[model samples]
Target chain A: MSFLFARDGHLLELGIDGLLAEELSAAERAELDQHLSTCAACQARVDEARALMAQPLPALASHTAETEEIKPPDLEQEWSAANNNRLWVATGVLLAVAAALLVVVLPSGSQPEAFTARGGELSLEVYRQTAGASQLLLDGDGAAPGDTLGFRVRLSEELHFALVGADSNDAVYAIWPPQGGSAAMGPMQAPEQLAAAIQLDATPGIERILAVACDAPFQLSDEQVLSISEAGDAPQVQEGCAQELVRLDKARP
Target chain B: MPPTLDIDQLYRRYGPLVLRRIRGFFRDPAEAEDVLQEVFVRVMESSDSFRGAARPSTWLYSVTTRHCLNRLRDAKRRRELLDEHGTAMGWGASAESAQQPAQLLIKQVWRELDPELLEMAVYYEVDGMSHGQIAELTGVSRRTVGNRLAQLAERAKDIGGGAR
Candidate 1:
């Protein structure tokens, strides 16, 4: 049933939700129109709503949508950025953990390998070698016949030559072509290269020896010699028994 | 048969009013520009489908208003965290003041007010959309949308008088 209330009281509910702009029921629409014509209060409220909508807003900047590239951001770039962020976060966490461990376990006096100590540098360590030794142990663990090794040496002062490793009980030696009367017995020392090489006799259970820094006793920095053991099979590029047999077979063909 | 409108010609004629409608919802100039561009893109893409359903200008307003409202709804969600966290307040300045009395109510009490009521007001007064349009957008009955808007306006006038 359609109920008609007093004119003053009718607009009370209408003001609550301002008048609806569209899709009015036939009855509600007729009632609103009838109220607007007869009651000035309802008409003023509608006028106010219309006036507010008429207020001007700022003008949009003139730009052609046709020519402008409004493409969305690149998905690949977004993924790459996310991955980079994760990588940096992971790296930062690892560095923090490593630093914490270093604080707890490493000696306070230890410095990075790249650090060059200033003032009164002394040679704290040295590896000594004589020319005729059978084998020289470069590290705490001697090299086996089939082991791969790497070596590094630093000098406090530039020198022409220095003997780095000595002959040990378990050593392997290689004999080369007979030395000419004028040729020196020991290898030439090159401090710039900071290393020397000597092939050992290819035999079972023999200790492969490297004679580095061999010409003379030279004074240098605390960084005298360094050697590290790596996990790998010995490289075999030169002529050996297996290579000889292959060469012989190829020659027959 | 209603003649097919050249959207560009219509834009030249009624673009200002339509832009103003969108400006009421989105505060950012860049976002308003995006909505305007979206309106034109949809019109251009669907030029053949208009098929004289409504006045070309009315259809443009309806389509453009719909796009702006959708953007505003999504933007409102994103701004919630910022608003609560005390980061970003309003979109520069445009989002501060409402274009209509009902919208002004929303801006002031939006923090404490119901979102559905606010959206009803926005769809009705700000966009000038029909109750059917609001119902379609909100998935509510036209009567419900009408009732909600009227109720919200009454509350706004009461609150506005108190502030005065």
Candidate 2:
């Protein structure tokens, strides 16, 4: 059958891959060489492939057996610990006020139910980078101010979502949609990290990172996020939204 | 026991080829990079399977192809692919004539095609693999590969005709 896109005499992509991998037999290589001498398009692809091959590989976080294992996070214990912390208690009044504001601002019937954290429905993987080495951060792990935090998530369903970070002072910051908008994400069977990483500021308290997924497109405006953070509540979304939260303790070096 | 596989060595050697192939399917470099990382992570996770393969590059090539195809099956990703290559759908237009016709055909009908046929289309048209080569890779007979490619060509023609 004649292929709609195939050039009659041009070399194939497999040939290019094999040529670069040095897997081609001498006869195949000679034929490709002769073809490359005449076909600029194929040669251009060869050159492009060669250039891509020469690029240095970036340092990837180690997924050693021990660190790669997924452990069920103890959210109840962590929440209790956060409440016991002096910083959390100091912000109690602000939280109470923010909670009241949230109640007033959110539409009564539209509020999404709290998403039960299931094993695979939604989960967050945190990677901490310090001094050029990247390590997976477990729940309640202490991260220093200068350390860079990268995030990845595993999801069972597609949803429009945003990652927001709330510090101990009840301040909220956008983490994923760096531009402060909701982005639609496909379901990730594996943990896929976000492209950008954020450096931890010198805030000595627990910073909660929440992954908020909704059925429809949703946005967490600065004011809404601040109110939610201050209220120590999850971001309010239309019905059908689910949330996953991970905590990082920010401590002095 | 399978031989131990060194992920760093594999990445240094095969990462580029994998990325190059992935770039064919994705227009966004960042998205391609994300897939590249995922591909390597898969390699790392299934090191024993990788180590047991006849050729590391070939193994990686197959893995990358399967991963990209599976990702394309996702509705969100399919939308992204269509958006990126939507203009290519104008196969008869002189303006889009510069684009690869096989790629244009893919952009037009990939969503409608099942995974097996889509995989065959990619192998036969995008990669320019011969029936025998595809047969070798997929473990199907060359005659079956030829029949599948013919079916793919017919489907593309139908889609192209409808689009026009």
Please name the candidate that would achieve the greatest TM-score relative to the true structure: 2
Cα lDDT tens digits for candidate 1, A1-253: 1112221233422221223334245776777678668876556645654564455533322223322322221222221111000000000111110121111010011001110111111111111212211111111222222111112122333322222221121211211111101111222111111122322112222121222221233232212211211221222222220100000000000
Model 1 chain B worst lDDT window (10 residues): B89-98
DockQ, candidate 1, vs. native dimer: 0.02
lDDT of 2 by residue, A133-219 (tens): 234554445556545565555566787778776665555666666655677775653445465555655545565667777778888
DockQ of each: 0.02, 0.10
User: Cα deviation of B124 in candidate 1 (Å)?
Assistant: 3.0
**If scored against the real structure, what TM-score would every candidate get?**
0.30, 0.51
- How do the residues B23-139 of candidate 2 rate in per-residue lDDT, one tens digit apiece? 766657777776777576556645655776666666677778866775555445566557667744221111122246676676667766655566666676556656766676655
- lDDT (10s digit) by residue, model 1, range B1-164: 23764655555545554555555455555556556655555455345545653344445545665444333333233354235533222211112122344344555554443445555555454433556766755557989887877776666676862211
Candidate 1 regions exceeding 4 Å error are A1-253, B1-5, B75-101, B104-120, B125-141, B144-164
Worst 10 residues of 2 chain A by lDDT: A104-113
